[model samples]
Target: MKNADNSRRAFVRFLAGSPLFLAAGIDGKSLHRLITGSTRDQGEAFDLIDQVSQDRQISSPGEALDIFDFEPVAKAKIPPAHWGYLITGTDDDGTIKANRDGYAKWSLRPRRLVDWSHLDTSATLLGHKYDTPIVICPLGSQKAFHSEGELAVARAAKAKNHLQVLSTVATTSIEDVIAARGAPVWWQLYHTSDWNQTRAMIKRAEAAGAPAVVFTVDLIGGSNRETMFREAMNDTRTCTNCHSGGQPRPGVSGRVDDRDNRRKPAFANPAPGAPIPEAGPPTWDYVKRIRDTTSMKVFVKGILTPEDAELAIQHGASGIFVSNHGGRADNSLRATVECLPDIVKQARGRLVIELDGGVRRGTDIFKALALGANAVGIGRPYIWGLGSFGQEGVEAVMMILRKELEIVMKQCGTTSVRGISPAYLASR
Candidate 1:
């Protein structure tokens, strides 16, 4: 099986680099996807489960796997609707497109003649040291994408010693993920209509040994994802695997609960007998509420502004997850990377700033750090890896970033993750 998969990858690579692919009018970038754009997934979608390929656990051939490799393979493997759900951003893909351009917004100043040997990418977040600043952001409904869902991702995180933030809507239970990986995982929370449930979740994370809580606050309403909706309507993959194996079918009434819950403000209406007459999205008071309820460090995940970052710090937050909810919440004009510098400037080292959205490469991670991000969060890349090769695929994705970051660090004379400063950046 290992030989076969490697052969397939090799064949695809050769085909794409061949004159035939280019003669077909495929650009150099699209050639790889065009060549690998066939059903290579060993698993089939059904009511029962996503079958694990015999090669699911096999390590890559030590050759780096990038999106060009992962994306096409995943596209061929996973169901179209699931793929669309994982990749699509809000209305017209404005934010997603903008995110890709964010890295180009700044230029790195490479310094030569420095002792660039033996680089370090390790970073410390909230007193926890990580092998890399690349964190796995909380993505929900893993079973929706693959049978392993959060479990596979956790396995990869464990192997890499990278930090992973689990979603509340994750198909794999929080306890199960921690049990599978035996690694300290952070939890991402959303205020449901039931504040009791919300509080219970926080308490659970603490009980489960979560060191921190990333309470996402950006998604107060839904945005347009016409692509996902269209794909769901057209997807041929059968049901029975939906809702982490509970729902009888996929796309019930075309409802995407994970996304729907995001846009709706948490605790939008007041609980009975509450002091507040009416309700809106949970405010800093809500931040205080969660902080008081748990012993764990608190971080706000959806911050895009200095004001919000300030409120999070003042409200006892240990850090800020500077994001645009991966541009899934609304068609915000600015990408999260574009928004990072201002937020970092405003934060003034008062908060541990992390960012997500458009972080597909190692250079992107380096830029975020150079512009004041303490860490970087990834959402789609890992999922693309997850669908392509299960746990090993995800591991390869991280390895790719780590390897690329090493190249950047070595080139830019940034010897340590801590050494990455604004001095390395020249705003474009």
Candidate 2:
């Protein structure tokens, strides 16, 4: 068995260096099965790539072996400061690690002698069915990562038929994103503290044919993203171009006054010397008001507790997006996955339960669904793809995750998204 494992590793290493490996777009999980065999009796770790070299650089989206491959390429292509913004989490960044670490607590128990073909990954959100259970979490200011930014992401989401939630601080306007996506997209609200501005934004989104408005509640107060501060020190570009109010300094998170109007089109053209419109904590009354103001379904994002989840349902929220703001919000050190079960129970199917944060694999999505998540959202993974190779990169990342989910469904003898349940999982 040891000899066979060594031989498989040797062959994978050879494949890593070959031209075909860079061009063939082979599945990374399949390679893992080949290298680790049916079991890991010796507990050897799965290394997707044991050898890294310039010669192995992927020139196209098809060349990427997994979702992780896009990160390094995105780093190579994006500016250091912008990359820092994308990578940073609050405080010590423990929450980010926790989000990924939380997945290790659960293990899938495969059932044998069952047909696994003809798998259906389609999922329904708010009476609408999408091609995949995976949805895109709203990431503001995509133009910072790529020239086309949200426009590119919109096109990619349209091509793959994935649901997209556009950020209030998105570089592109709601009208443009809808036009680019070729369909109505969900709008994530993060505008001014004033109710009028908020109402106007929601109305604009409605005018654009948005069916839902995701009100993110976690980022009311700002966070200390130390990593972004550190990376900004290395950026010699004229910060005033985008950050006209002032450049970001060490120990100081960028304020709304410091940002360029072009970066946040949602708050574009405010009165001169007027106070900047920023995200603030929304009360239950505020949520009810939002519900009363719009015909669109209201999804309350960033609830991490059963109590809060219950409150969302009480306030007429159509859904609960269980997230820790990708660990970029306050460092709560609680993973969205860890918070999912209780919230799901509290919701009791009263509202749709979706989650985002540290979803890097199809297995992660499967775990969330098993824990009672109706669907899951991904933030950084798709952004890495967008930053690395533009629209094609985004499409590739979604396709890779869809394929991975399908493979896991087959291996676990599950035939459909709704068919996945807690019975298929055990605590590790």
- By TM-score, who's the top model here? 2
Model 1, range 233-255, lDDT digits (tens) per residue? Answer: 65766544433333222333222
List candidate 1 segments past 4 Å from native.
1-65, 237-278
Model 1 pairs in collision: 47-240, 220-263, 221-263
Local lDDT at 191 for model 2? 46
RMSD of each: 9.0, 7.8
How many pairs of residues collide in each model?
3, 0
Error of 2 at 380 (Å): 0.7
Count backbone overlaps in model 2. 0
